[model samples]
Target: MVLSYMEGFLLGLGAAVPLGPINILIMNESVKRYKNGVIIGLGAMSSDITYLFLIMFGLMIYVNQPEILNGLSLFGGVFLIYLAYTIYKNRDTKIDIPIQQVAKKSSMKLYLKGYILTSVNPYTVGFWFSVSGYIAGKELNPFITLFGMLSAILLWITLMPYLVHRSRHKISQRVSHWISLVSSIILFGFGIMMFINLFYN
Candidate 1:
């Protein structure tokens, strides 16, 4: 049981550590407001937990169907392209908005942003599906495995915002612009690749 938990923890950590769209959003938010970044992370973590529950409980069996998978991939790809375009368009805009102005928006909005971003990501769905299937095949207790995975995800999300907050002083407008540009490019590339894969695979 301990080994099973450990394996799940490692898998969850590995998945969360990747510099995907969610991580990029968290970093961007962290530079702006540390609490907002943590809220985003919590939202992302919630999505992960939801996915794990669905996958582990056999509710995600339909995801294995090629047609359904392809549809999800298409939706995710389109969403990513839209997100990238929005980011690129705003890359040059100077954000002179006051912190007080930013504070007017509720934290729930930031949390929702994080939740929606992670929820729409087909890769995240696919990953959880695969991991759950693997765990099932190995005869591990699903509850224990999920607990481990959730623990790791929570830990990563908590630590990431704090670290980025600590380094917020080092980030400048130019640096932020570059980060946005690079992140948009990465997301665009992934979206394009996903579309391409639909034809090939």
Candidate 2:
């Protein structure tokens, strides 16, 4: 059981450590505003946990169907493109105001951004599906394995933002501009790739 948990932890850590959309958002937001960054991570993590639970318990089997996956992929592509534009448009944006100053409505918007983005990501959903299938044959306790994965994800989301937040200080508008620009490009590239795949697949 302990070995099973450790293996699951390693798997989760590997998956979460990659520089994907969620990590990218967390990094960019953390540099600008720590609270927002953490909130985004929390929201993303929440979505991840929900998916993990559902997938492991066989509630997400329908998601693997061809039509549904294509729909999700298309939506995810468009969503990423929109986010890229939004980020590029707001490249010079900064919300250095105190945490308390951030409006409740805006906070919820940020959280939703994180949640919806993760949710729509076909890659994330598919990856978890594969992982769950793999574990099913290995005789691992699904709950224990999921707990390990959850712990790994929780650790990443918390520590990652805090580190980025601590390191970035008095960041200039120029730096922010470049960061946003690069992030937008990466996101746009991913979105375009997804769109291209729609026709091929």
Candidate 3:
């Protein structure tokens, strides 16, 4: 059980540390306000917890269906495209509008953005399905694995925002602009790729 937990921790880090929509949002928001990023991560984490519960109840098989995955990809792709457009459109906006106050007011919106983004992402769903299937196939302890995964993910959520928040003072206007622009392009590219994959694969 201990060994399984250790392995699960490593797996969790592997899964969460990779470049993904949630990570991008966390990093981008952290540069402006620590709480924004932390809330986003918490929201994303909530969706993951939901899937973990489904897996625990042996309902992940439904999520593995091709049609369901494809449907998620479709929605995710469209939503991502819209977000890209929104970010690019507001590229000229300044961050000096008192982020703490704005964050308090827009807390729900930001949380929903993170939760919706993760929930619609086919990759996120597929990955969880795959991981759960692997554990079941191996006859491993699901509770131990899930506990480790939760711990590692929580660690990431805490540390990542703190680090970015600390360095936010050094980031300049031009750098921030480029970050937004590049993020917009990358998100657009991801959306296009998701669409292309649906037809090709």
Candidate 4:
């Protein structure tokens, strides 16, 4: 269980460390309003864990049935393209908004946003299912594997906010925009890969 947990945490870190609109939003908020930035990152992180839990709990098995994976792949591809277009269209907008006292949105809302964003990609679900399946196939305990997965999510959510906060200001705005663009391209590539896999398999 300990070994599995460490491996899962490392996997989660690798997945979350990449730059995206969510990360950009976190960074943007952090530079101007520290607390809210943390909140946004927390939201994304929470969402990721929720997806992790869903995958661990056998939701993917159901989703993978009856060509649902194919549907997911198609939807994910379109979603990526739409996200890319939106980002490209708004690439020049200055995002530095002034901070003000406001009612705090529930953490549940943040968690759901993160969860839904992560859940949109069927490939991700498939990947997790494969990992868990491998362990179960090898006769490992499902409960322990779940604990490991949870550990990974905890490590990611706990550290990502601080990392984003620390690094946001060090990079130039142009650089940040470029990073976001690259992230979009990567997402698009994943979408394409998922589409191909859906048909090839």
Prediction 3 global C-alpha lDDT: 0.82
- lDDT scores in order: 0.78, 0.82, 0.82, 0.59
Clashing pairs in 3: none
Q: List ranges where model 4 is wrong by over 4 Å.
A: 1-4, 7-60, 95-113, 195-201
Tens digits of lDDT, candidate 4, 29-73: 444345655565566555555655777676755766647767766
**lDDT score of residue 116 within candidate 1:** 72
Residue-wise lDDT of candidate 2 within 150-193, one digit each (tens)?
Answer: 88888888899989888776667788789899999999988888
lDDT (Cα, tens digit) per residue for candidate 1, span 1-201? 897899888888988898887888787667666787889889988888787667756787765678877886787778778778877887754434555665433789878877877876777777887887788799987777777888898888889988987775667778879977987898798788878978788
Instruction: Judge candidate 4 against the unseen true structure and give its global Cα lDDT, from 0 to 1.
Output: 0.59
Give the per-residue Cα lDDT of candidate 3 at 156.
96
Candidate ranking under TM-score, highest first, comes to: 3, 2, 1, 4
Q: For candidate 1, what is the lDDT?
A: 0.78
Q: Which residue pairs show backbone clashes in model 1?
A: none
Model 3 lDDT, residue 22, Cα: 79
- Superposed by TM-score, candidate 2 places the C-alpha of residue 156 at a distance from the truth, in angstroms, of 0.6
Candidate RMSDs in Å, in order, are 2.6, 2.1, 1.9, 4.5
Q: Which prediction has the highest TM-score against the true structure?
A: 3
TM-score of each: 0.83, 0.90, 0.90, 0.65
